[model samples]
Target chain A: MTVATAGEFGLISRVTARLGAASPLVQLGPGDDAALVAAPDGRVVASTDVLVEGRHFRRDWSAARDIGHRAAAANLADIAAMGARPTALLVALCTPASLEIAWAEELADGLAAEAGKVGAVVVGGDTSASPTLTVAVTALGTLEGREPLVRSGARPGDVVAVCGRIGYAAAGYTILSRGFRSPKLLVEAHRRPQVPYAAGPAGALLGATSMIDVSDGLLADLGHVATASGVGIDLRRSAFVVPEQMRDAATALGVDPYGWILAGGDDHALAATFPSSVRLPDEWRIVGEVLPASLFTAGDGVTVDGRRYTGGAPGWDHFR
Target chain B: MTVATAGEFGLISRVTARLGAASPLVQLGPGDDAALVAAPDGRVVASTDVLVEGRHFRRDWSAARDIGHRAAAANLADIAAMGARPTALLVALCTPASLEIAWAEELADGLAAEAGKVGAVVVGGDTSASPTLTVAVTALGTLEGREPLVRSGARPGDVVAVCGRIGYAAAGYTILSRGFRSPKLLVEAHRRPQVPYAAGPAGALLGATSMIDVSDGLLADLGHVATASGVGIDLRRSAFVVPEQMRDAATALGVDPYGWILAGGDDHALAATFPSSVRLPDEWRIVGEVLPASLFTAGDGVTVDGRRYTGGAPGWDHFR
Candidate 1:
């Protein structure tokens, strides 16, 4: 979009018009120094992500609605990764003035739509004219009377499990890279991810030790847990679970399904170290184990027998 | 600055090296799904603002320190405007990968420096590679037992007052626009504004009827109060209590001093309407009264010797 000077209808003004107080948690909305939210509990889990046009997303590849959904999703995923219930989001947008008003409205619509999915609200935001479009979203969540699941809590014998889809966004990227229109399912996943919002809080309830969301590839993100916890991780590849459809899609693209399962990212799946005795939910696929050493390698029959998963996975690296 | 690919030792990794968990509010800093914050009050006052490379600032005109300070100040000012005690800030930054690590470090220093002034901390943030630099900050404030001051409660005959500098930014812009590089004070004022952080909670304590920050010139922002609260506003031109230093600067530029006071934006001073009997702060300048009607006009303002003061105040107009 062409860059225009700040118009009569600027971003901050438009934002004030499009929303109102929609929840009890939001005691105040846009027109204040800060929004007063009913935290109910004393602790708040907050996360922020920056999405720049031509970097995090391409406008040509995604709709304005998708941008809004994805923008909120990115930060919401972070809150979930911390094993916290998603609550409210504050967005800051810098867009070229000449961009269509409809783009922004649709983005707001997408924002509201996605926010409604997790029972969260858009509390406050700021906007201004800029050369390129940029969105910064901050998500706040409540712990609801529980200790936060930190990345440094994993132990030697904990079970490694994952909740929600893995590799869908990466698979979708392959379609985009090949210049082929993704099947409706893959493209939808690429635009707005379906994060297990309940799973984070649930994992905490089920005694999750160290946890993280698969924003970067599973291995890279889990690598963080291992590094932080001072332990090694060993994956059992044979025990890996993939839906029939995702497996079929990987087969059709002539790519190794293991890569998507092992390295693909942005599915926002919840991965955690659970106690060996606990029974994980059917949605959560158990595929690995925590070990004593500080290494990431394959175990008995997985990618293993002897193979080691060295280096980082091919995920969304901001600065490679 | 050259644009580096994802593989370069870009900002995210560099920032990771410079950062530590220095604040108590930040339970989790970087390298986690999201940061865990201690919302001890069970309520949070949140606000967000986006600063672009050109529209909000100029790299050539301001140092990286000033840019960082200004960016954090803008959002923190919003929290202060809300009658909330500033607590922590989450920053999402997009910059050219080749931008000096020292520049990024200085920017971080600037953010921390400003946050320190208000007793706030940088709890969480994300960095990404982008062509042009952009900074978006989401400030979280803790309202320690106070009702938030909003812009929808003004009443007729309420005394309107401003706490802090009004036209200094505009005056500085005039100097910058005229290629005057010798003066340091005007440039410093333009780059780093000293917002009255404590005045907001004080105003709230004094039972302010309505409030807003003077980000968009005094009259223009006050216009929002008139529009939202459905009250007319009239100012006393004779009540101009501007400092003498500003007068000298305006004279040096051969520009009308009232123009800066009226139309210049980005001062971020607090403007509120309170009962006439309220004890005023030293920083506050009594400027006008809330009228009974719904529209704003010159007749509502103060006159000198039976004649209206016709000196023009070019309230900042975004469209213009």
Candidate 2:
């Protein structure tokens, strides 16, 4: 049945039922006007992102479940980047009146599934009718007695490390846009990224000085760290040899795999900087080095093997 | 310059500069992937709402500043409804690429204005290009060691009280739609509501049993409280006796002022229940009585002076 037939209240009731039980941190859940969640560390890390239909995702390219999962992953990755354990998510979904109730239910299922992976809960949200579909998610996380890892602390002489795969999403985008149906894994990675939820806290425990989530490509996100920390990041190309999964898609499209890895957005990997003296954990791959700001050159903010990236676009820019 | 011309990074830099300095609660602010805020109560209250163009507001009817202020007010009202003191807001704005940068700046100004009223800050948010304009805001609040006042606690003997104006927005909406330009205040009220931000916590301090924000009209919101509390609310029509402001609009439009008083939405007033013996604060007006669920009639949900409402629609329903 469509949402109109079910009515707003009925649709909300159905969605609430499918979201399962609330986490212990949630003092009050959806039935209330607002959800109350415990922030035991006396602090809460918060972030939000809005996804619009046709602009953020297309129905033809992504299923409802994929859209929901991706939205949750994107926001959760923000919290994780702050060196906090995600605790809750609040979603605001606006859809056309003709949308199917089942689609909304499936969306809720995907949000719950992705949130559960990080031991978080969908505490509360709002739904409304609109001319197009839009999903806005706010993720809240706890510091758990640790100081937050911000982007402004990547000092020179720090080792740059990453905790998950990058560039798969961009590769999948190329494949889907070009209508190449093979290489199911890359396509799945683009549609629904499985972010490394534990890697953030692990890095914080390992004394990561600064961290960021690779939502807007390795070079672009690291550039933010560079600008904030007043440092330059030099990535080692040898440490980033193209993985076998991306090589198949790259060869099929006749494009450089490096382009995808350097400029891909939406992979949601944790890119962090640690002191050179600290021993890196097994989960982290030392891929680059942090350099002093004086070493940076104009128009070559982030370098790979001491050379500028030859990719067509530096990274994704929504307004561009 | 338009957003496209300014570019995403430049636009973000301009917005950040306009938002001014962060509050002390914000350990980390807008420059990071996420914001870390001190939740001194050891818990955070979170809620979000998405406002779509043409659905939630018309640009022709509202100034950019008014739209931003209303969006922040809508989400902050949710946190207030839970009897929490709002602490921070995260706004997600989606607009066409052609949108002027000045409009975006005005939006930030409005958000900051409303948030500042409650000593809150705009810590972090997202922006993207879309076919139409949309504003999604997530508000976080602190409980400050008090139990949340939910909709399920209104007992039969509780006295229904309201701390802000009702039906003014609906009256203004009617006046605007009818092209009556004489009532400038009412029309302005429709564009930007003045929510009673302090009343939520004040009511809780005064031992409110149940509370809700009047975003969907008094009767409709009361129905939520009634259903959750399993009781019937009998509104005293005499108590409402249309205020002079609404009376002028009703008379100009040739309509009953009672209709707007009972069903007008968007005022964002605080409606709450208190034990009969407690003295009602001067800021709050006594309006009704809660009756046992057994006393409720099959066809009458929320009654006015012991009769079912004969007005057109009880309240707004998104999917209806």
Candidate 3:
């Protein structure tokens, strides 16, 4: 049955029934006016993200479950980017009344599964009927007594490093736009980002200076850190080892893989700056270094091999 | 300039510039990946609400500022209903690209102004482009070491009370629907609800057994409390004091004011059950009494005097 037939409360119950056990941090769950979550560190970290159909995703291209995973990853990664452990999620969904109830149930399942990866739970949400389908998620987390790893901590001489996949989702998007789906790995990455959630707090524990999730491409997001911290970032072009599958996909699409590696977004990878003397873990691949702001002009803080990137547009903007 | 011309980052900077000083509870505010808010009580109370254009509010009926106030009030009231002091709000806006920048700025002003009423601040939010205009707000609050006032705690001997205006917004809505706007007080109430932010914690302190926000009319919401608490609620129709203006409007519209008070929605009044021995403040009007579950059949737990309310539809259902 469609959501319109199921009605608001009925659809809500059907979807919520698919969720697993609540996180221990949740003092109260759904079915109430509000949820109570433990904030043992005396502070709570919160972030919000809205995903609109056709703009952020298309039902024809993604399953309901994949969209749920993508939405949850988009916000949960932000919490991790702040060097916090995600604890609870409050989702607000606005869908057309014609939406299938089973689709919404699978969406909830995807959200629950993704949240489970980081020990978080979907504690509560609101639902409404609209002509457009949109999911707005708010993630709340705890810092565990550590100072938040903000975008303004990168200093001169700090080494820049990244963990997890970087350009796979963009490559997948390119392939999908071309009506080709043979590269299942890239296609799946585009549908559901594999965010490196653990690396955020790990970077903090290891004394990383600053960090951000790669939602708007590496260069574009790094530009944000550079502007916030008043520093310049210079990347070593040779340091990036393009994966075999990505190179293959780029070759099939007749495009340079470097463009995707440098400018692609939605990978949800963690990019961070650390003291040059800090010994990094195996997953943290050093790719660049933070430099003095005097080395670059305003709004052009990121350089490739000591020069401005001649590649395509740096990142995605909601409205261009 | 329109949001498309201003771009996402430009629109964000423009709107955030209109905000006042940050709340003391906020350790970090907007412009970061996430906001860090103080939760001194060791637990955070969170709620989310989504308001869609045309469904929840109309541009011609309510100004952008009023829409913002309404959206923020909806979520903040949910937090208050849980007996918490609101600390921060995270808003997500999905708007068409052609939306005017000035409209968005004024909307932000309204959100901030309403949040200021309860000492809460808009800490951070997300923006996206959509065909529909929607505002989803998530409110975070602190309980101050008190247990949450849930809806499932009422007993047979508790007294049902209400704190704040009931049926004003509904009356205003009816007036607006009929194209008669002379009742300025009721019309403004429809544009923006005057939520009793402080009464929630006071109710909890006075040992309220059960509590809920009246977002779905008195009888409908009381029915929810009765169902959850496994009790029955019997309201005295003679106890209601209808304002002269409302009665006049009802007469002009050829309707019953009692129907508006008992079956109309969106007033955002707080309804709670207190022990019979508790002396309620003047703002809280005792309107009903709680009875044993055996006194009523399933799904018919709330009665007016001694009969089921046959005035009209009891409440709203989003899909139905």
Candidate 4:
């Protein structure tokens, strides 16, 4: 219903219907102010993200559909990181009342498009008038009788493995930052990331030790696993750059690939510490190992290469 | 820590403590860009809402704390309406960076206060720079073992009942519209809504024929139920409007008390249809009966009291 190519129901109808077609956890999907999600385990996995017009996405940088995808991908990745299967999504959008209605619809199209990739669907949301376009999304996932994988579960000597690409989102971000104009792959990465949507549950199925989504840089995110587990994590520079997709934007930007690989964020990749014997998925690779709290030699929470990445740009700080 | 009443910590400290609170359902709560929610029943319920500064609330009209409470209440109440117990909340805030840190903190206080009432904790959220204050909340709920109660379950011959006050919110809104000066009761209702949070699950337990939260005016909300259920609902205006409270606001607004009683919305009350043999709770009163479609009408495509309330203000359109 949303315009796939040219003429469609615009963004509202198309995206609404697309989401509607999915098996809803609740009794309803879009068209209402909110969607209903079901929780059978007497528990639910929930998360939210808000994308501002200029802060999270740029109209000049993305198609409306792509924006929707980015929003869904961001939130869905959160649910996935919990080792939960994404069930539904709630989205509230605020934009200038005069903005193209089609644009809003397209955004939904993008959202449905991305959500479909992981079998997640938009359930419900709100709309309002505002000077800037703000998209707030909440993703829900089912635990499916499994214990949640938490950041605190990492223990010393647990092997740190990633289920998706790191630094690629940052690498993609670097390309956009340099004012490059191709706007295909990198821009798509920035707009709609293909996070290892299923890898989260895969890790959980394998009894993952601890898990997380890589929205922030690997160092910072892994640092959280360290702090939560009350242990330390030491990255192997050797294993850090094994992935080459990270090199594209690094070469283009003339910056150290390690920074993006280690400190760049927004890939929505899944990172978890597993017992050394746990088998990892194909994309997954050993990046580090959990250490005793006193043994952390990264020295004051710097990247693997010992480069400090903090302050306003230490990945995506909401306030900064 | 957000008010003069007690101890508070830096944002970082507060976020840190909340992150570790253990719950079997929560794989993650905070310390990252997003938190994970476990879906029981292999499904999850998701919904989102965005509140604008002046359009949704006026700083002069409602305390920042109250605004925070209302924002959370609105969405949490929605999840409840689906017969779901609220589990986690994600918030997105966009405000003028120059706003006092206290304002933001106070807002957080309000959010935590109300979220506590629903047994839901704030999990994770994003904060950013904006010209105006914006609070967007996404609430997730678990359905447990029962099927979700939806607006479409009502059938002909079902008894229509309500579990909370119908027009109190509209009455309160009227007071705010008249100029933020009103009795404490009226002002409080506008600032903080008291929803029948328990009744939603109760409805599930009671085998509600169909249900919906009375958010947009009783008639409007019923219309949704009727449309969804493919049935008609005939309300006995006589059932609504008890003396003390209705008189209290009516005296202030000096309008027909019935206007607020029937046309006003945002009460967050639960309206449901049930079998006639089911004993209703004292907190609820039977107001109508579901009939075959085309049996009742209000305004436009709707009918109330043989009079159509067709001055379409548009019960909250999306994208403003």
Candidate 5:
């Protein structure tokens, strides 16, 4: 039956029943007006993100579970980018009343599964009826008393590194747009990003100077760091090792693999900068170096191999 | 300029500039992947609510600033219902690209104004382009070393009371629905609820057995408390003192004022149960008492003067 027939309270009960137990950090779970979560560090880190139906996902292209994963990853990655441990999640969903109840239940299951990967849980949420389906998630985290790895801390001599997949999601999107779904790996990447959630706190422990999740493409997000920290960033093209499967998919799609690596977004990869003296971990691949902002023209702080990028559009902008 | 022409970053900058300085509790504010707020009591209270266009609000009836106030109040009142002090707010805005930039700015002003009343600030948020305009807000609060007053704490012998306006919003809504807006007080109440922010913590301090915010009419929300606490609530109709203006509006609309007081929602008044021996503050008015759950039939936990409420619909449901 559709959600309209089940009603708001009935749908809530059905979806909440599918969710696993909440995290220990959640002192009070759902069934209350508000949730109480432990903030052991005396400070709580919070972030919010909204994903619209057509703007962020298409139901035909992805399953409800995949959409749930993507929505939760968008906000959870933000918390991880701050070098914090995610503890709880709050979701506010707006959906057409005609949608099936099973879709929402699967969505909740996906959210819980993704959150479980990082030792977090869905504590509470709200639901409403709207013409377009929308999911807004709020992620709460704790820093464990460590200083946050903000975007403004990168220095000119810091080494730039990345610890997760890049360009795969864009390749997947291209595949789906072309109606070719044989490449399951690439297609799944577009559906649900494989975020390296642990790498954020690990990099923070390794004394990373600055960090950000690659949501608006690698170059675009790094541009934020360079602008915020008043430094220039120079990337080496050879640093990104293209997977054999991805190369085959790119060849089939007739596009440059490096373009996707440079400008593709939605992978939620962790990109960070560290001091030149720091020993790097095996998971982090050195890709670039920070430079003095004075060396570049104003408002242009990112380059490839010490030259301006000749790739296509730099990144995603909502209203643009 | 419209949001489409201004772009996402430009609109964000414009709206954020209108907000006042951050609260001291916010260690790190906007312009980051996440915001860090102090949670001094070692726990944080959180809640989220979404307002959809033409559902939760109507742009033709209420200004953008009023909608903003209403959205923020809905979530902030949830935090207050838990007897916590609000410290921060995070907003996720989804809007049509054609929306005016000034409308968003005014909305930000209203959010800041409402948050400022509780010594909180807008710390961070996300923006997206959507076919419909929607605003989702998440509020964070701290308890300051006091036990949270949840909905399941009431006993059979407790006194039920309410603080703040109960029927004003419903009255205002009725007036506005009929295409007559001469009564400025009722119309304004419908646009923005004046929540008794301090009364929640004060009631908790005075040994409240259970507390809730009246969002779904007096009897309907009280039904929630009754179900959670496993008790029955019986209200004294004589205890209600309908405002003279409300009575006049009810007479003009050819409706029952008592129905509005009993079944109306969205006033955001505080409803709580206290031990019979506790001396309540002057703001609270005794209106009802808790009874054994056996006194009522299954799934029926609220009564008006020893009988089931004869009012129309009990409360709102997003999907029905």
Candidate 6:
């Protein structure tokens, strides 16, 4: 049935009933004006992101469930990037009156599935009718007595590392944009990102100094770290392993795979810096090194080896 | 300059720089992937709401600053309705690329102003370019060792009370819809609601067993309390003191003021139930009583003067 036919209260009941009881972390759940969650350590890590239908995802390119999963991943990755364990998620969804109830249910199913990956719950959310579809997710996490990882903490002598896939989503995006159907796995990577949730808190425990999630492309995200820490980052081109799938897709599209590797976003990978003396975990691989500000011009926040990236930073800009 | 000219990072810096330092509740703030907020009591209350540009507000009807203020109030009121003190707000805004940079700056200004009312901070947010404007806000609160006031706790003999302005915003909506230019106060109320921020925690301290914000409408909100508590709510018609402004506007529109009083929403007033023997604080006025479930038909969740509301509860419905 369409949501418009079933009505608001009925739709809320159906969605909440499908969501089941709140997890143990939630002291109070749905049916209340707000959900109460246990924050244990007297602190909570919070972040939010909004996904517009056409701008963030295409209905034709993504399933309802995939859209939901991707939205959850984006916010959950932010919490993880802060070196906190994700505890709960609150979703605010906007859709049109003609939307099917099944679509929303599928979206909820996807949200629950992704949230369950890290043992978090969908605590509460709001739904409204709009001319277009938009999904806004807010993820909350608990530090569990550990200090949060911030971008500003990176030191000049630190080693930069990344855990999880890079350039795959970009490859997927290119394949889809070019209407090439091959490379199914790369397309899947663009649809549902497998964010490294465990690696975040693990990195903090392993004495990582600073961390960030790869949402706005690697170089763009690391640029945030560089500016915040007042240090320059020098990435080794040889350290990156170009997957056969990305290479194939790049060949098919006649575009440089390295561009996607450097600029592609939505991968939700963990980019962090560790002290030079610390042995990095198996989940992380060294990709670059943090350098003193004097090593590069201020305009060149991140350098590819000793030379500046002549192509400039390849990244997503919301307004551009 | 437009956001398209300044770029995403530049726009974010402009907004955050204007916001200045973080509040005491925020352990970490902007520039990080996520913000860390002190929750003190080990429990956090969270609520989220999405406001679509045309559905919730119009750029022509309200200023950009007012839109931000209203969005903050909507989510903050939900936290207050749950009987918690608001701590922080995370905003996710989607606007078109051609939006003036001044509009975004004014929006941040309004957000900061409203958050400051309850000593809450705008810790972090996401911005993206979309075809239309949408503002989604999530408010986090601390219980501070108090149990949240859920809807299920009202007893048969409990007194129904209300705090803050009721029916004003709805009246304002009616005025604006009909194209009446006079009664500027009512119009202002509709543009930016004055939610009773302190009354929530105060109600909890005074032993409010059940509560909800009047965003949907007096009768509609009370109906939730009734259904959740498995009791009937009987409001006294004469108890409500019609404001001179509302009365003047109602007369001008040739509509029953009670229609606005009973049905008008977006007022964000506090409606709550307390034990019959307790004296409500000055902030609250006794407006009704709780009755046994057997008192009326199952469909008559809320009544006025011991009779089922014949006009069919006036309230906002998203799909309707």
Highest DockQ: which candidate?
3
Which pairs, if any, clash in model 1? A33-B78, A33-B82, A319-B6, A320-B6, A320-B7, B263-B314, B263-B315, B263-B316
The digit string of per-residue lDDT tens for model 6 on A246-287 reads 887788788888888888899999999999999986889899
Local distance difference test, each candidate:
0.76, 0.87, 0.92, 0.72, 0.91, 0.89
Q: Per-residue lDDT of B1-320 in model 5, one digit per residue for the tens?
A: 99999998889899989887767799999888899999998999999988999888889889999998998898889989998889999999999999999999999988998998999899989999999899999999999999998999999999999999989998998898899985888889889999998998999999999999998788878988999999999999999999989999999999999988998989999999999999988899999999999989854599989998877877778875
Local accuracy of candidate 4 as per-residue lDDT tens digits, B182-235? 667756787788888899888889889777777767777787787777777777
> List-wise, what DockQ does each model earn?
0.60, 0.84, 0.91, 0.38, 0.90, 0.85
Per-residue error at B148 for model 5, in Å?
A: 0.9
| Candidate 1 residue spans exceeding 4 A from truth | A1-21, A242-245, A294-306, A310-313, B1-10, B16-21, B294-320
Output the better candidate (3/6) by lDDT.
3
> What does the lDDT read for residue A257 in candidate 2?
93
Clashing pairs in 5: none
TM-score of each: 0.92, 0.98, 0.98, 0.84, 0.99, 0.98
Q: lDDT by residue for model 2 over B134-236, one digit each (tens)?
A: 8889999998988898999999999999888788888878887786754777778878889999989888999999999998889889999999989999999
In Å, residue B57's CA in model 5 sits off its true spot by 0.7
Q: Candidate 2: which docking quality band? A: high
Candidate 1 per-residue lDDT, tens place, A1-320, comes to: 22244354465566556654387777777665567787677778888988888877888889989989888888887887677777788887777767777688778878877887888888878776666688888999888878888888989899889898887887777777677776767767877788887898889888889788888778777777877787777778787766676778778888877787778777888899998988888978887888886344432112222256543354567754
The TM-scores, chain A only, for the candidates as listed are 0.91, 0.97, 0.98, 0.88, 0.98, 0.97
Sorted on lDDT, highest at the top, how do the candidates line up? Answer: 3, 5, 6, 2, 1, 4
At residue A191, give the lDDT of candidate 1: 77
Give me candidate 2's TM-score against the actual structure: 0.98
TM-score of chain B of each: 0.89, 0.97, 0.98, 0.88, 0.98, 0.97
lDDT of model 2 at position B67: 88
Q: Please estimate how well model 6 matches the true structure, expressed as its whole-model Cα lDDT.
A: 0.89
Q: Give each candidate's interface RMSD in Å.
A: 2.7, 1.1, 0.6, 5.9, 0.7, 1.0
Single out the weakest 10-residue window by summed lDDT for candidate 4 chain A: A1-10
CA shift of A56, model 4, Å: 1.1
True contacts kept of 2: 0.89
